[model samples]
Target: MTGPSIVVAGGGSAGHIEPALAFADAVRRLRPDARVTALGTERGLDTTLIPARGYPLELIPPVPLPRKPSGDLLRLPGRVRGAVARVREVLSGVDADAVVGFGGYVALPAYLGARGRVPVVVHEANARAGLANKVGARFAEAVAVAVAGSGLPGEQVVGMPLRRSITGLDRVALRAEARAFFRLPPRGPVLLVFGGSQGARTLNTAVAEALPGLVRAGVAVLHAHGRGGQAAPPAPGYVPLPYIERMDLAYAAADAVLGRCGMTTVAEVTAVGLPAVYVPLPHGNGEQALNAAPVVAAGGGVLVEDAELTGERALAELLPLLTDPRRLAAMGAAARASGHADADERLARLVLDIVYRHNLESARGAVGSDDRATEVLRPDPRVWRQQ
Candidate 1:
């Protein structure tokens, strides 16, 4: 099959953008001649990250649907119509064969614009479906999810698409180099702590207060405090940085992880076979806790409430795990078993399958077989919606 021109859409945070980029990379790998265009909002991190990764990103105005009565709510219809119109223009200009949506403000427009004209594939990274994905799924030919029971129509558990750097990481081989890079001790179990890209104050404070106990237990600390946050005054065995550019290296150097259970973070840590203690964010729709449930159930990690994650609580729980090599190894093995390293390839295959099916239907339609073409071209009722 000739490479199909595809539009991949999503952005805002690394969670959505990362998966979209990973999937795009996979498509290119499968079809070197593939022309992949990314659609994202200008307000998102994609303005920088997408171009840096060498993919062309077309900017769209964000169509944020206000949930409550307000001025933005009143303007919602106009905003959505404008965004969708702009997206449709881009799709036609690019001659897109299909669209893959990874659920964000940008995804709704992309999905709406491409619904009837192209094969639409929606990927939901969270265990719980987001609002954008919920609407996208209504018209999507295929719906992929990171976890089971996402409540989206036609949902298939294709796992999360991880970057090549992370999927190809060799933690065992790079252990020494990683330790040296992070200025960690040559010998001693390392505990890696991070929240998201913005850093969680709860995590930082808890870990800081617990550092003395962790250090006394011969556990080295490598903390990524996010932007503007610093490590609690420098102490022996504690290394803190505002952000970690190379997370693969940090994973390689760590014996266990302490952080929030965002889908990307949990997926990456488990993919690399790292035991973790996940603290789901206290706010939002409670999806973070849901994201961590499977990992904790699989014995790959532990889940702690945000309120319970104090320095004292951390020491009480993590000290024993860090000290016991056998237990740590067992947890790592469980994590590796539970993680899906081939998720990128799996999702790519799904997208290609949809494209191929659409092509076959288009060819049949061109042959003038009205009944056959209609049957082939009709949208599946399970996914199709009037709006």
Candidate 2:
């Protein structure tokens, strides 16, 4: 018998793509015979990263909804129609049993195309719901979120779907290897800092200015400044790189983190039990601050306004935390308590449950069953109950 086919959709930044990939990996692990296809746009990072990770990627035209009245807004209907048509073709070709979306331009079409035809599952990765996900949630059979109260219908907080490297990481056992990989001294406490994939000018500048103070306080630094960003000048206790390919190593090497509060960053740091100092982006929809709120409330991290995160301010706040082992250890434990390392598994199980229910519905329809018990769908109660 041909195994069930699943379509996983999302891609733009690493935030969306990584989770989609993690969920796909989980599905493959759980059901080796399952066929998984990734739906993404050519315009985003998915074009390169998806194929590189060994998944067959189906491309769809991007239908970006314009916030303001413009030419793009006028043409939006035609673009959406085309994208949805393309998604339908892909879904039919794969005989998709379920469509799982991680919320991106590509996901909106997948959700629309699969609605009423197959089971649809949506995963919202931010505290603030994006337009794509907001719409998808309305039609989705199962809606999952990384943060609570995300303004979506039937939202279940399943945490972020994390990469296997992160979920399976043994930070304590790999500490020596990670430190050696970065060429840092094995003895001192190392602080890891980075913005998102595109890098943050504010963080880069503040850390550059604060390096002397950190070095003096016996703290070593591993800085991934993002692609094309200027590296800090060499110092005895500082290591600077434009990008970090092996983030698991970086996390393993660090005692604490100083970074933005993007959903993926917050999830990864807390999963590994690393204390953090989060500086939410000053601009945008203010979701970053909301993303870091639960962790901060849990005493896993501290949140500072972007404006207040100066070199001196960072040193003043971080120095005390770095010097105090007991406080750092307490914060680490709190972080781990707040994080869900099994998020990928939970999401994968949700997908499978949707597929199972879809198959059952199909079977019921074929038999013309009138029994309410046969019609009533119950997913794995344990999986659905994950908060």
Candidate 3:
């Protein structure tokens, strides 16, 4: 295990990449000499993200597959084969001991790319399993999950890993610093809105339409409209930016939050103890909603059906909550209770254990027995690929 090299793979969005990077940092902490490299498709945010994090990144080709059976199904086998070949080629060049997938189309190739004896570990960040993670799970020595009930094999609830910067901040100090950083009135209640890494158009539109009403009611706003969301500034109390460079500031100053229910979003809000109004993406299965359910059930935040969230409707719900300071305080406390602060370390330990065990087993005569041996938790497969 000396100077062990690990490949952290999966990226298309910041959600997947951030967790991978966090785990890499944890690996460095555990073994300062450990070499970590990131593998992702050229198309994902990894191009800028991986490099910015100061990791060596290898570009792979795209692996696009429909969630459902489609004409794309015909290309799956060939695409997976090609991706596997490319992954193998990458592994050949690196001194890798294990490959870790963070759940995405890119993870499929990452797991498939491994040659004999190298263990593969995966992290699934939702209650419902993702397709790439599902396939990769079959090859995994262990699969770490953010939620308890995922259908993947060998799954353990590790909580969603967050960056050290986020994990280390003190909430009270952060809030004061955040308000100052955003130039908001120190005494006013702040409402934060975002639509994940790539803004949600529907969410953006509704929030924009509701902005004036929010401002009139005396609420201060720090909104991350995303590149896809509205770019125009709404009014005086509201600040609309293409993106928020310092998420710590955005999270710190917020009394209430409005955003999508992606796993990373849910984790960060919970970690920061920010009350939220989660609008799940409507199209794919109910994965986003599922991701937010435990928090809503715990009274940490309210869940709004995307289709039913009209501008008037959102205003009616949000205004009352924002106007009530006591209620916001209660919700904020509940949100903080949902965070597992040591998630990154827990997941990193799980991965390292799996890698060590798999390697040890291979050194013994236990070869093929470890390949398909996974801790299977029965999840409804019908729901795994939906969202």
Quick one: best TM-score, which candidate?
A: 2
List the candidates ranked by lDDT, beginning with the highest: 2, 1, 3
Q: What value of lDDT does candidate 2 attain over all alpha carbons?
A: 0.88
Task: Give per-residue lDDT, candidate 1, residue 289.
Answer: 90
**What are the per-residue Cα lDDT tens digits for candidate 3 across 95-211?**
688998998878888888873548888899988988888888887788888877889987888888899777776667877778888887786778888886568787777877887
* TM agreement with the true structure for every prediction: 0.93, 0.94, 0.86
Clashes (backbone N, CA, C under 3 Å), per candidate, total 0, 0, 2
| Model 3 TM | 0.86
What lDDT does each candidate get?
Answer: 0.87, 0.88, 0.80
Question: Which whole-number lDDT from 0 to 100 does residue 100 have in model 2?
Answer: 92
Where model 2 places Cα greater than 4 Å from the true spot, the runs are 368-387
Selected candidate, larger TM-score, 2 vs 3: 2
Q: Count steric clashes of candidate 1.
A: 0
Q: What's the CA error at residue 302 for candidate 2, in Å?
A: 0.3
